[model samples]
Target: MQRVKAVICYDGTHFSGWQVQPGKRTVQQEMERALTRIHKGEHTPVVSSGRTDSSVHALGQVIHFDTTLAVPEDRWPKALNQLLAPDVQVMETSFVDSSFHARFDAVEKTYRYRVHLTKERDIFRRHYVYFYPYPVRVEDMKQAAPYLTGTHDFSSFCSSRTDVTDMVRTVHEITVEEDGDELHFTFRGSGFLYNMVRIMAGTLLEVGKGLRRPEDMPAVVEAKNRESAGNTAPGHALYLVEVRYE
Candidate 1:
């Protein structure tokens, strides 16, 4: 048997999520189905770098799996794509050491949230962009971002549904960028809790709207309560940009 690693991208609009669930369609299920077919019906399990909620897209999500098949590493993507749906594609593949893990070995991840600065929604991007027509000061949002950087117990920024008790994580950077009629919020961190990025996006949006001051961020982090954060931004606007390993 050999281990293989692959980077994949998917449009999560139709997927229940990345994980397998009874009576639900998921990215894992689809991938494993393709692999199982190639393995002549033997089950092949795949592990991902992390899970993305329903409607959340991925540009460079990573996965690893062990298989008995002797397919060439360079040909794995072509083989997998032929059997998988168009919405999910295997972008690249490589042979990995037996000890390398997709999730545990990941050192950092980057997620980007796209906000369309328009009151009207466009048909082309309705499923990929968050439309917010409200007035927001980009400068205020920039000022609030620094408060969320660095290592901290991100309990307030995490979702109440998150099962992890240790909420402390290092955020290497949080950048808010504006391009034309869209605002792109990029978050790079060692790791992120469930809903952490979304909540932070919402909170920063509030800062831009003048509902909260930039300085209020310090107290919000100190609160360590889920209620202290703002609304959870819609998952459709979030994308798993990349996962880094060392």
Candidate 2:
């Protein structure tokens, strides 16, 4: 058997998520189904770098699967693309060392949340961005972002439904950039809990709207309670920008 790694990009608008679920359309399900067809009806298991929530798109999601067939690496993309849905595309594929793992070997992840701030929605960006047609205090949000940097227990910013007990995570950086009515929030971190980026976006939005002060960030982190944080932002505005492996 040979271990194959693939880089995939998908518009998650039509997917239930990345993982396979019974009676649902998903990125992984489609990929595995394509593989099954290639293997003459035998199910092939595929593993992803991480799970992304519904409506959350991906620009550089990585996945791996072991196959016995001797297909050329370059042909993998063409083969899979022919069978995958229009929204899911296999961008690249290659043979990798058997020891490599998509999830366990990942060193860092980057996520981005996009917000379009215009009274008149842009038809082009409506499907990809969250539209908030209100005034935003960008400076306040910038100031609050620093407090969230560094290692901390992020229980307040994580989904209460998360099953993991360890909520501590190291945030390498948080960048807030604006271009006219568009705002991009980039988060680079070692790892993130379920809905962590969305919650962070929501908290920062609250800071921008003057509902929460920048100074409250440290206290919010200290509180470690889900109720102490702001609302969970919509999933459609979030994207898995990249995953880094050492």
Candidate 3:
């Protein structure tokens, strides 16, 4: 058997999420169905680097699957794209070592949350960006973001329903930038808990609105309570930007 790694990108507007669910349409379900059809009667499961929540898009999501058939790596992308939906496309494919596991081998993940801060939202970009009519002070958001960079117990930023026991994770970087009327929040971390990025974005938005002091980040983090943090931003604004492996 040979292991093949596929890089995928999806719009995520029509699917429930990335994982396969029993009665719901999903990215993994579509990919697995396509693989089953390509392999004729054989069925293969595609393992993704991570699970993205509903309405969250991906730009460089990676997955790996083992197959018995010997197909040229270069043809994988074209063949899969032909079978996959227009919103989901296989960007690239390569032969990987048999021992390489997509989820286990992943070392880092980056996500970007986009917000359009203006009186009127752009009709063309409405599906991708969250529209907030209030004025956002980008400098205030940047000043508050550095406190979240580094290893910390992020229970306050995570969803209350998250079952993960360990809340400590390393945030390599957190950047807030403005492009015209759009505000971008980019976070690079070793791993993330459920709703962590969205909550962080919401907290940063509070700081930008002068509702939260920049110096309060440490205290808020130490609180380790979800209620101490701001509301979770919409999942549609979040994108799985990239995944890195060693």
Best candidate according to TM-score: 1
- Give the top-scoring candidate (lDDT): 1
Q: TM-scores of the models, in the given order?
A: 0.99, 0.97, 0.97
In the range 1-246, model 3's lDDT, one tens digit per residue, is 989999999998888999999999999999999999889958899999988988899999999999887789888999888888899999999999999999989999999999999898789987799889997678888999999889999999998786789999999999998887789999999998889999999999999988998899989999999999998998888999999999
TM-score of 3: 0.97
lDDT of each: 0.95, 0.92, 0.91
Cα RMSDs, all models: 0.7, 1.1, 1.0
Residue pairs with backbone atoms closer than 3 Å in model 1 (clashes): none
Of candidates 3 and 1, the better by lDDT: 1
lDDT comparing candidate 3 with the true structure = 0.91
Q: Tens-digit lDDT track for model 1 on 56-117?
A: 99999999999988899999999999999999999999999999999999999999999999
Give stretches of model 3 more than 4 Å off: none
